[model samples]
Target: MRFRKFTSSFDTEDRLSITIDDIARPLSSIQSSFEGGKVPSEFVAPLTKFAERYGGGSFSSLFAEGKSARQKQKLVEEFGSVLYSMETEEVKNEETFLIWRDACRDIIDWGLKVDFMLDHLKQAARDFFGYMLRPSGSESSCREIIQMEEAISQLRKKLLHLEQKLGEAREDLHLRLGDDISSDSMSCILGSSWVPQSRASRGLY
Candidate 1:
């Protein structure tokens, strides 16, 4: 039996409406900045590494694992640190700095989009449970509800598995990026207050 019928009430259709174009624009802008010599020469190597690994050499590849918010957020933090460091240089080349700065902002924007998509999914899950709890009068409805319960249980298992994988990925990212780039520095560069907030605290993961 199709589970889509049961999930239809959760308004998830728009969640799936995120187009490749929406994801590609920022990535393409970053690439263009690199190619046009807008990014500083010192940053090119590390930025290239960051793009290939996190961006998968293309925006579409970044979302290949299904709009993972954790992955996107990690990318933002890593690259935002690099961008912030670049901006701290004493050189007064405003044009080049602006180009690079916009590219960094684009990365954050891309990450926020992923976060928004995940939020939609979480809300949809909540709505599904709420809808399922409503009283039903018919035998057919009851049977469908039973099927939905089973489906939701399986979904919970899958979500847990994904969460575990995400945790592993986070550890891997930390190992690859190293400890030299501090969160406090990134937060200062991004103009955001830094505090230790676990994944659970943020309602993400």
Candidate 2:
């Protein structure tokens, strides 16, 4: 999400940082990037599809209602007035006001950009959640939902396998405790961290 602007611009030759990689990672090894430096042509199509359907508008205004740069400029005008007023009370603070106003303006721009990018990423995640529910029916069709389904199917198989392992946990009439995926008390329930109980000594068996 920090790298949402990567959606705004890229070429077949462009390299990516880890943040962009996380968002636009290849679906399978067939679409994977090369070691250290591979152009991101494979990801651009889906990202473009996402931007068109869900971005609301231009890359500059992706998740935001308006252009963040223009909004930042408006904020500068409003806050610069306050900085100027503060300067009037001090000893020839013209340079100081200029410095503080510029710094604050930069900070505001950064905050707005970061906020919009992160929001855009969160919205994309929500969209994909719906897409996973009904892959072919979703508007985001550029992405290969089959790949996602395969990954999820693999996970389901693993969970079923784990349930088989847990079936072996039935011993000495001890009721095996299972947990929801959230695993609220899982840490205390596992391994050396577990405190042994005295059920055998109590003659309950």
Candidate 3:
């Protein structure tokens, strides 16, 4: 199918709608099935390593960057400024309005990154899950791969819930924030090949 542009009119991304279909294809659909335990050349190592090392010391916290000094400082400052404005007076002007709007966008940015990472992890697990299904693999290893797949399943559910909360919260930020925010999140959309179009794609997995 040809790609469509992202231009959602709803506060919540109506992911099934024509507007959101391209940018908000559910993460579960990001990787098409790998028939007969096959995967693309680029994915073999990452998919394999991810399936094995998950839930172990080798894996990193998903929130490390989100909670890092720089990100914390930035979010704190933005929150404080927006809160200060709200406490002092209503945000009526474009400046104060945009400040609040941007603060919300920043929050969305974090959510998007986390969602993207989780999607990547789950997709990696899926690819590896398929890889493990090769006839020569041990039964115990097959069980282990299934376990990882089940664990990763939670990520997609959480992201769906997150998108709902984010959409709801955007109401207070103003209904148009989705439109006002750059098509930046547009870049987060993925196709069946597993390429993430966003800058958030870098180092995601």
Q: Lowest lDDT 10-mer window, candidate 1?
A: 19-28
RMSD of each: 27.5, 23.0, 31.8
Better of 2 and 3 by TM-score: 3
Indicate which candidate wins on lDDT. Answer: 1
- Pairs that collide in candidate 1 are none
lDDT of 1 at 174: 66
Worst 10 residues of 2 by lDDT: 17-26
lDDT-sorted candidate list, best first: 1, 3, 2
lDDT of 3 by residue, 114-153 (tens): 2343234234434444454457847688799889988889
* Comparison by TM-score, 1 against 3, better one: 1
lDDT of 3 at 92: 28
TM-score of each: 0.23, 0.19, 0.21
By lDDT, is 1 or 2 better? 1
Clashes of 3: 0
* Count of clashing residue pairs in every prediction: 0, 0, 0
> How would you encode candidate 1's per-residue C-alpha lDDT over 113-173 as one tens digit per residue?
2333333334544545545555776757878989999999999999999999988986676
